[model samples]
Structures are given as C-alpha cells and as structure tokens.
Target: MRQTWRWFGPKDLTSIDDITQAGAEGVVSALHHVPNGVVWTKEEIAKRHSEISTRKDGSASGLTWDVVESLPVTEDMKKQKGDWREHIANYKISMRNLADSGIETICYNFMPVLDWTRTDLRWQVAHGGSCMRFDIADFAAFDIHILKRPGAPADFTNAIADEAGRRFEAMSEDDKKQLARNVTMGLPGSTESMSLEDVQAHLNEYGAISRDQLRQHFIHFLEEVVPTAEDLGLRLCCHPDDPPFALLGLPRIMSTAEDYKYILDAVDSPANGMTFCTGSLGARPDNDLPAIVEQFAEKIHFLHLRNVKRDNDDIMGSFYEAEHLGGDTDMVAVIAAVIKEERRRKAAGRKDWQIPMRPDHGQDILDDLGRRAQPGYPTIGRMKGLAELRGVFTALEHGAFGLK
Candidate 1:
C-alpha cells in the first residue's frame, strides 16, 4: 500500500510542507479553481504539478500529484442536459491532458447535486473534540421542513417523520438556517457550493429520473470516456455515494457493491475502476469492507481508509466519523485484506499494484480545536489518523499477527 495525502490547494491551511512532514508519500489533489466541464489545459496541469513538487527556494518537495480526488463531472453531464455532449468531450480532453501530466488515477462521483451531505459539520464530541455527523432526524428535518422537497415526507417512515417534525419544531430560526446550510454544504475544498434554492432546483431537475435511468446515464458516460482513459493507460475510478443511499428523492445509482459490479461489467476494462472508500461504503451495514476488498481487488485503484461509528444497526441510520480503528470496520482485518491483495498482485506481476491509500477524515482533537479548519479536516487530527493507520500497516507488514 502506498501512502498519500489529499491537499486542496495553496489556500488550504495544510500546505505541501505540512503534508511532507506528515510522512505521506504522494498527494491527491485537483485543480479546484477551474469550473466544471471545462477542459483542463496542459499548461494548468503542469502548473499544479510544479506546485506539488517544487518549493519556493527551487528545491524538490519529493511529492507528486499522484491521484486526482476528482476531475468534477458537471451537473449537466450527470443529467445529460444542456451541453452535456460538449461537457463529455471536454472531460475526455481533460483526461488526456492529465495522463500526459503523469497522474494515473482519477476519482469522480455521480451523486446528483450534492457530493456529500451531513446534518452537522461540527457536532461536539467528548473532551470538546468534534467531527461531522449525519443525524437522520436532522437530515429529515432539513428535507421535509427546510428545503420542503416534494415526496420527502413519504420517503421517511411514520416514526422518522414524527421525530423530524418535532426536531424542526424545537429548533430556533438560526438553528434552522444553520441546519440548512450545514446539510447542503456540498463538497469541501471545491468550487461547487450550493444554497437551499439551488438544492430545490437540482431536485426539480432530477424529478422523474429513476435508478435504472441514472445507471444508464452513468454507463453512457463511461462508454464515452472510459475508452479514452484506457487508451491513455489511465484509471478512471468512481467514488461510491457519500451516504450510499437515496436522499431527498434523488436517484442514487453508484452506492453499493452490486452497483460497482454493474458498471465494471458494463465497461469490462481495467481503466474503468473503483475508489474503495471504506468510510462511505461502511456507512451501509451490509457493505462488508474486507469481503468487498477481496472481491473487487482487481478494480480498486485507490483507497480511502477511514471508519464511521453507526448510531443504529440498520443501513439507514445516523453515523459519525470515528477514530481510525474505533468504528464499525475492522481496521486490522481490512488492512490485512489489502495486504493480501497486494501480495497476490505482486505474485501475478502486475505493474500498477501499489494502491494509493490515504488516511481520510479525522475527528477534531487537541490543538485542532480552535483552528477552524475545513470542517472535518483538522491539521493535527489528520496527522494523528495517519499515525494510527501507519501503526496498523507496520504491524501487518512486519508480520505482527503472522499474516505477513
């Protein structure tokens, strides 16, 4: 397994120097300033590459832009509306440019309007530490009362609806506004921030689209772009849905293992791949992380190794970002499975075997308290997560448990 860090840009509180200090081997980043569906030029790509590797003093930082967290697929591309064909062509051009720049892995998602939704951006935890949480009641309150999304009431059960109603009734005006803002915060460190009105418009745009139609749209997208990635020896890895379930009546197609199987089989190429995000897939109770890793070992090009503590036993419940080893996932077992897959790949003599794994979000703690960092992305907190993950990896690689 290869270690990487996700850096937003020069504007992020954590700099490339900080990432180097954290002991990460590579950087996962994107050109966030550029608008969606616009072709990323070779000049811009080379500029970001230099920014990742070169220092102010003309020294080498020993880091490269190894993986793109996303090359954003525009709202129009997903909906196939208004210049989507042009957007698809632009996406192809961007992929070719990125490959020419030597970045092999590309991550993207198809979760309609919102990239990732949470009801609380900074829910207080023990010892004054905080992390993001997805409270079902709070989300239902936002959907049923705040955004007033049509058919949202019917989407929730009667008991959930009643609780959401009470939650909405009990909130102050400011609290209601804050809930709306937090839930629709969209992808952090990106250009696509949405408002409550924007949410309504997007939901209206996807009004009658079902799961089948959305999956077909994704397949069509792959049909157009996956071949380009294949010809260029690029890995087009799709990230699973954040919550891995439907929300606000929007169709969620890429949220499950079977969903991935459908897409991989549809394209049947190594270039068409998956970003095995344990935190996102572990949100669903049925998504066994180790088994999924073992089964999809051939196609997983990148890994986001984080865990979440589920509030309920069911799939559709609340969850919070837990410590690296303290959530529903068996961290050691998952790492073991990953190591096993790497060994198998090495035995088979596959060139692209070292999967780039990053220590994803962490709970706020210690000096991370007052930094006001990007919601879940605290400086010391993520360093702590990286340390813990490195410990597990060391134990596994050194044969601490006899597997190695």
Candidate 2:
C-alpha cells in the first residue's frame, strides 16, 4: 500500500510540510480554484505539480501529486443537458493534460446536487472527541419540515417521520438555519454555492429521472470518457456515494457492490475502476466489508479506509465516524484482504501493484478541536488514523495475518 494524504490546496490550513510530517509518500489534491466545466490547461496542471514538488524557499520537497481526489464532473455532463458534449470534450482534454504531467489516478463521483450530506457537523461521541455524524431523524426533519420536498413523507417509516416532527419542534430558529447550511456544504471548492430554495429547485428538476435513468446517464458518460482515459494511460476511479443510499428523493445508483460491478461491466476497460470507500459502503449493515474488498479487489484503484458505526437495523440508519480501530468494521480483516490482493498482483507482474489509500475521516480529538483546517481533514485526527492503519499493514505483513 502507498500512503497518501488529501490536501486541499495552497490555502489549506494543513500545509504540504504537515503531510510530510505524517509520513505520507504522496499528496492527493485537485485544482480547486478552477470551475467545474472549464478545461484544466497543461500550464495549470504543471503549476500545481511545481507547488507540490517545491517549497516556499524554492528547495525540493520530494513529494509528488500522485492522485487527484477529483476532477469535478459537472451537472450538465451527468444529465447530458446544456453543453454536455462540450464538457465531455473538455474532460478528455483535462485527462490528457494530467497524464502528460505524470499523474495517473483520478477520482470522481456521480452524485447529484450535494456531495456528502451530514445533519450534524459535531456530534459528541462517548469519549471526549467529536466526529461528523448523519442522523436520520434530523435529515428527515430537514427534508419534510424544512426543505418541503414533494414526496419526503413516503421515503421514511412512520416512526421516523414522527421523531423528525418532534426534533424539528424542539430546535430553535438558529439551529434550524444552521442545520440547513450543514447539509448543503457540497464539494470543497464547488463553483456554484446553493441555498435552500436552490436545493428545492434542483430536486424538482430530478422528479422525472428514476434510478435506472441515472445509471444509464452515468454509463453514457463513461462510454465517452473511458476510451480517452485508456489512451492516456490514466486510471479513472469513481467514488461511491457518501452515505450509499437515497436522500431527498434523489436516485443513488452507485451505492452497492452490484452497482459497481454493473458500471465496470458497462465500460469493460482497464482505465475504468472504483475508489473503494469503506466508510460510505460500511454505513449499510448489509455491506460485508472484507467480502466486498476481495470480491472487487481487481477494480479498486484507490481506497478510503475509514469506519462508521451504524445506529439502526435498516438501510437508512444513522451513522457517525469512529476512531480507526474502535469502529464496528474489522480493520484487521479488511487490511489483510488488501494485502492478499497486492501479493496476487505482484505475482502477476503488473506495473500498478501498489494501491494508493488515505485515512478518510477522523474524530476531532485533542489539539484538533479548534484547528483552522477543513472539517474532517484535521491534521492531528488524520495523523492518528494513518498511524493506526500503517500499524495494521505492518502487522499483517509480519505474520499477524500469517502472510509472513
């Protein structure tokens, strides 16, 4: 496994020096300042490469931008609407520029409107630490009472609806407004910032689109872009939906393992791959983490190894981010499966044997309580996760899992 860290940009509170201190071998970042539909010029790509390799005093940092966390697939491209063809052309050009600049992995997603929805940004855990949480009742309150979507009532059970009603009544005016902002945080550097009214308008537009339609749209997208990626020697990894379930009546086609197999089969190319995110897929109890890892190990190009403790028995359960080894996921088993896959790849003499992974999210503990870094990208929190995961890899390779 190749250890990497997700860095926002030059303006990020956590600097490249900080990533170096964490012992990460590479940096995962994007040209966040550029708009969604715009083409990333070779000059722009080279400038970011220069920044990652050089320091403030113009000396060498020895770190390279190995993977792009995303290359921002816009709404028009997903829906095949206004300027969709033009956007596809631009996306291919960006892939060529990135390949020419020596970056191989690019991660993206097909989620509409929101990137990741969380009802509470700071939900206190049993310990003194706080983690990002998604509460079903609070989300229901926002959907039914706050956002007032057309069919919000039919999605959840009667019990969930009743609880949501009570929660909304208990919340003060300030709490409701803040809850609205938290859910719409979207991508880190999205070109368009939306409001509550804008969210409703977007949902209204998707009323006619079903889950099957969305899946077809995504396949249509890959049909155009995957060939370009294969030609450019780039591996395009699609990130799973954050919660891996339907929310606010939007279709979530890329949530389950079956969804991944369907898309990979549709594009049937070496360039098309999956970003195996344990945190999102683990939010559902039915998703067996280790089994899923081995089942699609060949297609997984990037990894996001974080755990979440689910609250309810159903698919739409509430979940909160947990410490690296403290969560319900069997971290040791998951890492063992990853190791087994790498050994298999090495025996086959594949060039891309070592997979790139980063600690996804962490609890706000100790010094990270008041940090200026992005929420979930805290320096101390992620360093702790990286150390814990590295220990897992070390132990497994040294006979802990009998690999030695």
Candidate 3:
C-alpha cells in the first residue's frame, strides 16, 4: 500500500512539513475552498498541485498529491433536483482537470445531508486522551427534541426513544446547542457550517426519496461520471456511510457489504470502486471486516485503516475511535487480506496493484489536544497510528506471519 495523509490545504493546522516529517509518501487532499457544484478549474487544480508540491521557502516538499480525498457530490446531484445536470457536467469537468494534473484516484461519498455525524467530537477515553464518538441515544435526542423532525420518534425503537427523551430532558440549553453544532459541523473539507434551519431544509428535500430512489440516483450519478472517469483512467471510489446506518429519518444506501456489491454491480466498471474504510464498516457488528476486504479487493482503490471500539454488540449503537490495533477490527487479519490481494494483482501483472491508504482518524492525545488540529486528525496521534500500521505492514510483507 502507498502511505498517504489527508491534508486540508494551507489553512490546515497540520502543515506540509508535518506530513513529510511523519514519513508519508504522498498526500490526499482536495480544492476544499471550491463549492460543491462549481467546476474545479485547471488553474485552481494547478494552484493546489503547486501548493502540495512547493513549500513556503520555494523548495520542493518531495511529495505529490496522490489522491483527491473527495470531490463533493452536492445534494442537488444526490436528489437529482435543482440544476443536477449542470452539477454532473461540472463533475465530469473536474475529473478531467484532476486527471490532466496526474491524479488517477478519487474518493467520494453518497451519504445524504451531513457527510458524517458524531454526537461528541471530543469524548474522553479511559487513557485520558479524547476521540470522536457516536452515541445513538444522543443522536436520537437531537432528532426527537432538538431538530424536532417529523416522524423522528417513530424512527427509533421504544427503548431508544425513551432513552432519548431522558437525555433530552437532562441536557441544558448550552448542551443542546453543542450537540447540534457537533452533529452539523459541516463537511470534512468545507469551512461552511450548517445552521439548524439548513439541516432541516436538506432533510425536507429528501423526505420523499426512499432508499431505493436515492440508490438509483447514486447509480445515475455513477453512470454519468464513471464513463468519463473510465475514459480518463481515473478510479472513483465511494466512501461508505459513517456508522453505516440511517440517521434523521434519512435512508442510507452504502452501509453494508451487500450495499457495496449492489452499487458495484449496477455500475460495473473498473473506474467505479470502493474506498474500504474499516472504522465506518466496523461500526456495524455484523460486518466481517477481513471477509469484506477479500470479497471486494479487486474493486477497492483506497483504504482508511482507522478502527473503532463499539459500545455493544448491537448493529446500531455507540462507538469511539480506538487505537489502530486496539479496536474491534482484527487489524492483523485485515492487513493480511490486503497483502494477499496485492500478491494476486502482482501475479496478474497489474501496474496499479498498490492501494493508497491513510491513517484516517486518530485520538487527540499528548500535545495534540493543545495543537487543536482538525478534530480526529492530530499530528502525534496519526503519526503514532501510521507508525503502528507501518510496523504491521512490514511484518506482513516480510513473511513474519508465516504467509510465505
């Protein structure tokens, strides 16, 4: 696997020097300032490329942007409403621009409304460090009382609904506001924050769209852009829904292995693929992580190798970011599967055999809490994770596990 890091451009607290110092081979970033529907112009892409390659002293950073973490798919495109065709055209144009600049892998998502959700951005862990967490009861509390979406209560089981009510009643006004901000903390790359009204409006637009309808729209999207991607020799990978379940009464399509197989079958092409994120998929108790990797190895183009500590055995429940090797996922088995796939691809004489992977989310530990880098993206935290993952990769590659 090619080691990479997700950089949020110049405005990010984690600087280019930090990435290099951490020993990443390449970068994963995007023109985050660019809006969702706008075309990423050649000039803008060039500027970003220069930013990634050149440093403040005009010296080469000895790194290149390996992958576009995301090229935002707007709500209009997902719903197929309000100038969605134009958005699709702009998406194709962006793909062409990115390809022209030597980028071949793109990661995106089809989750509705918020790109991802977490009820607590800094939940304190037993180790005294903090990490992002998702408490189903807290989320339900926001949905039932704070956002007050219609039929929100019906979406939850009676036990969850009751627990949510208790939590809601216990929260102070400031607590409720913080929870709302945490839930709608904007997309990963963008700076814009969504107000409560903004979230409600987005939910309203999708009120009539069912899981099947939203899925077809996703396929339509793939149909429109996957051909262009194929022509450009670009790999388009869709990220699974975080937590891998429904939220705010919205339908989630890309949450399970079956979900991915369905979409992959729908848009069957080399250009269409999956971004295998262990943390996201592992949130669901039923998902066999290593099995899924083996099943879809050929279709996976990118990897987010973070892990999560699930609160319980339930499919939908709380989970917090766990250490790379300390979570529910069998990191050793997963890496073994990936290595096996790489061997298969090598035997087949494939050029793009190595997948690009990033140490996704890390706990906010050590000086990380003070540096206040992006929530889950701490300097020391991720460096620690990458170091651990590199150790695992080296052990597996050298036949230390007896795979030889």
Top candidate, metric lDDT:
3
Candidate 3: clashing pairs of residues: none
lDDT of 3 at 372: 73
Q: How much is 249 displaced in model 3, in angstroms?
A: 0.8
Q: What digit string (tens of lDDT, one per residue) describes model 2 on residues 9-99?
A: 8887778788888899998999999988899999999989888887666778789999998898888887767888998899999999999
Q: For model 3, state the Cα shift of residue 78 in Å.
A: 0.4
Q: lDDT (0-100) at residue 365 of candidate 1?
A: 89
lDDT of each: 0.89, 0.87, 0.92
Sorting all predicted structures by TM-score, with the top scorer first, yields: 3, 1, 2
The per-residue C-alpha lDDT of model 1 at residue 9 equals: 83
- Candidate 3 — what's its lDDT? 0.92
- Against the hidden reference, what TM-scores do the models get? 0.97, 0.97, 0.98
190 Cα displacement, candidate 3 (Å): 3.5
Q: Which stretches of candidate 3 lie over 4 Å from their true place?
A: 399-402
For 1-404, candidate 3 gives per-residue lDDT tens digits of 99999999999988888888899999999988888899999999999889888867888999899999899999999999999999999999999999999999999999998888999989999989999999999999999999999999998889999999999999999999999988897486754558999999999999999999999999999999999999999999999999799888889999999999999999999999999999999999999999999999999999999999998998888999999999999998999999899889989998789989999989999999888777788989999999999999998888555467
lDDT (Cα, tens digit) per residue for candidate 1, span 1-404: 89999988888788888888999999999988888889999999998999999666678999999999889988898889999999999999999999998989999988898889888888888768999999998999999998888788998888999999999999999999899888878764653357888888888989978889889999999999988998999998999998998998988887888999998999899999999999999999998889999889989999999999999887788999998888999988999998899888999999888999999988888877877677778888888889999998888888556475
Candidate 2 lDDT (Cα, whole model)? 0.87
Best TM-score among the predictions, by candidate number: 3
> What is candidate 1's local distance difference test score?
0.89
